[model samples]
Target: MTEHATRHTPPEGPPGDGDVLLVTDLSRRFGDLIAVDGVSFRVGRGETYGLLGPNGAGKTTTISMVAGLIEADAGTVTVKGHRMGPARVEPKRHIGLVPQELAIYPELTARENLTFFGRLQGMSGTTLASRVEDVLDVIGLSDRAKDPTKEFSGGMKRRLNIGIGLLHEPELLILDEPTVGVDPQSRNSILESVESLSTAGMAVLYTTHYMEEAERLCDRIGIIDSGLLQAEGTRDELIRLTGDVDHIRLDGSGDTVAAEAALLALPAVEQVDRERHTLHLAVHDAPTAIAEIVTEATSAGMRLNDVQITRPNLESVFLRLTGKALRD
Candidate 1:
């Protein structure tokens, strides 16, 4: 786990006026197992915050508490200045959750599904009709709005489910891996929709184990593992915690021993590992170090076939903090 001091301290009273969701020292237990322990974070308007972790990482449980699906054993969730809970109508009204599982009725058309959910939210007449049309267009389902959901692919259905959540025009949108099991096109569409929503100033709480997704979608990320928030920050901020190094791969034919010796002499090169024809160098600043690295390798009698620099990314940060790959 990352150091605790770096974590944000919970505010003295309610969420700040600018914050949409404030989770403080949230803890949960299922019998003897502690699913979420003292996990806390805040989401601001127009900001997308991501919770990333492996399976059984308490991500769902944490979101469940935040969504008021289940009461937390301890801690508080403040949404738009109101405490959150299953029975808390006002706060719940501000939340829109797009669950991992499809919640739309397959028999209903896309527009019909949005309308039905809107009605359930107490909307009607032109207001409901206009919102439904807007959601269909946002989800890119306007052309097929009249088609029965049963005729839709898994991706289309997923998009419809998202449209249903969006229908209410909630201030806070919680998406629990909304793209899982969808086709590539649908996934991209969903991601694009999320980007637009954020740009339009909706607060989004997203949970996913996909490193690329977190990097691309989230304004900030909270890495959860074994129920605890292991780390939290922007992608670059977290990567800096892993000693801020870059990896360079040299693939070619030559005496590996001389190449390793030469790279070790460079000020930026910190470590070198040889794997057959490849020499992997852990160094600082690839862009500034590459030319020198290439020249030094050739001078040491290493014929470079290909030189590739792998920058530190969320995947590397995940490995450094959690002691496991993002997928693992």
Candidate 2:
């Protein structure tokens, strides 16, 4: 199929409106290793913002500091214009965190877990009970609230983990790989729940290595690597970082190896990958570059069976920035 034409627009300057959460020059260290180095970004109210990076990219360390689980060696984190720290207890009320690890007790029922957390947050009696039930319904676990968490499926356990965070209805919900290890059905359910929360005006700081999840869920995403904010914008904005390149998929025969190398030598070619009979290429300009590729293949006695060129996607953008696939 013919690739759709897309215009790449540059990222605009920071938003003029007040940000709900802001971090400036955030840094963390583990001895000589700089786990989080000078990361900075802002999340707007009612915005679904994503922090995307591979493992050990400092995503967790940054969020941990923002959530007050760890103190930053330098930098400041502000929530609703109030700075974060031990003394900022009021700001703590404005933030909720769903960590990568399940924080609930396996021995406790889902309701018990939620209630326990609610009480620790200063809730009690009927107020705590009602809130637990409310979040149970929000997480689609109202019917299973009485079941011990250990007996639940992986997806159910994940939902309950999220429920524990939402019990207090904090203004900003930070989710760290909430869908990891869950079944596809469960992952979809959790994603839908997150979307619903954003629709209800809850600002979310979502951290994940899953490109598709970020593309589907985030209003904007911040790409971090090696302790720095490499890029920040919507998926389209990030894709623009890869210049004007568009992607083309080709299936052909007759020494695919030579064809792959030859395509990479073409002017305006940015990236090329050959897997079996399928070849994926990113080029500076699709129309001209694809034509040249087809001509070269034909000259080399290759039979081209299928060709598909697509506009640059988040995956392409990610590959360009990180020099590695998202899964890698």
Candidate 3:
């Protein structure tokens, strides 16, 4: 079981400024193996909360339970004060889920797909038509509204997937790795769409293995590993939990093995790794240690090609706590 610092009781009414999604002691099991073990966190109104972990870290299982697609073995999921279970229609109404897969129909036009989902959500007539138009504008596909989705680009299809989620304008939006296989241009478009959605006051629960996305889009993040929530907080708070360390990378030719050993012997250096021509070092005080590192490289007969000092961020924090890369 995972331990939480504090526990919150389910509120009586709509989650007043406190939280939109409150998950407490959530755990799930598959026969003999526990998938999600005691995860807990809260996402406030209009806030973006990121759930980050490596593959098989239980992120998908946890999200499946939250979406009411699977029943939890133990614990509670409260969405805007309503408890979520197999037959909870009200809570489900408040959530719009955009899964990792393409949920839009390839044969239908963008507008048609929106209308189809909008009507399924109980929309109709003028309201449904207006919503479809509005969603097309929001997704930047108004020009392509009448074009068949099969003709759309990968990014456009992804945007349409998100449009399906917004057809009902649910109070909370859950996006699961929406940018997986798209090109850089398409990825940026999808990210911009997410930012706009949050600005429109929709609480978002996002799951991604990409550290940059989590850092850019999340107001707070929960890091889960091995079925446990290792830490949960804002980026700064999570980084602080990993202690103050700066990551430095040096790319050079010649004697990388000797350079790696010399850097590791430094008093400020915590770890050293060498990959062919590149050397990665984690140090206590980077600003003061840069000169020492260069000196050590010179003394070790390394022909330096490039040097970079990167400040610690979510990736570093994740590496510190999980002891594995996020992509792993």
lDDT of the candidates, in the order given:
0.89, 0.83, 0.86
lDDT of 3: 0.86
Q: How big is the RMSD of model 1?
A: 3.3
Using lDDT as the measure, which candidate wins? Answer: 1
Top-TM-score structure, candidate number = 1
lDDT of 1 at 290: 94
Backbone clash count for every predicted candidate, in the order shown: 0, 0, 0
Clashing pairs in 2: none
TM-score, one value per model: 0.85, 0.78, 0.77
Native RMSD of candidate 3 (Å): 6.1
Model 2 CA deviation exceeding 4 Å by range: 1-18, 247-307
Q: What's the lDDT of the predicted structure labeled candidate 1?
A: 0.89
**Model 3 C-alpha lDDT per residue in residues 1-328, reported as the tens digit of each score:** 1232222222344445658898888999999889998888888877999999888888888888888889999988988889988788889888998998998899999998999888778889999999888889988899999899999988899989998998899888999888889899989988888888888888999999899999999998998887788888888778767685788999989898998999899998999988889999998768899999999987998999898998788887777776778888
- Model 1, runs deviating above 4 Å: 1-14, 251-280, 287-305
Q: Could you give the candidate ranking by lDDT, starting with the highest?
A: 1, 3, 2
Alpha carbon deviation, residue 316, candidate 2 (Å): 2.3
lDDT of 1 by residue, 179-265 (tens): 889888889989999999999999999999888899999999998888888878898777776677889999999887898999999
Find the number of clashing residue pairs for candidate 1: 0
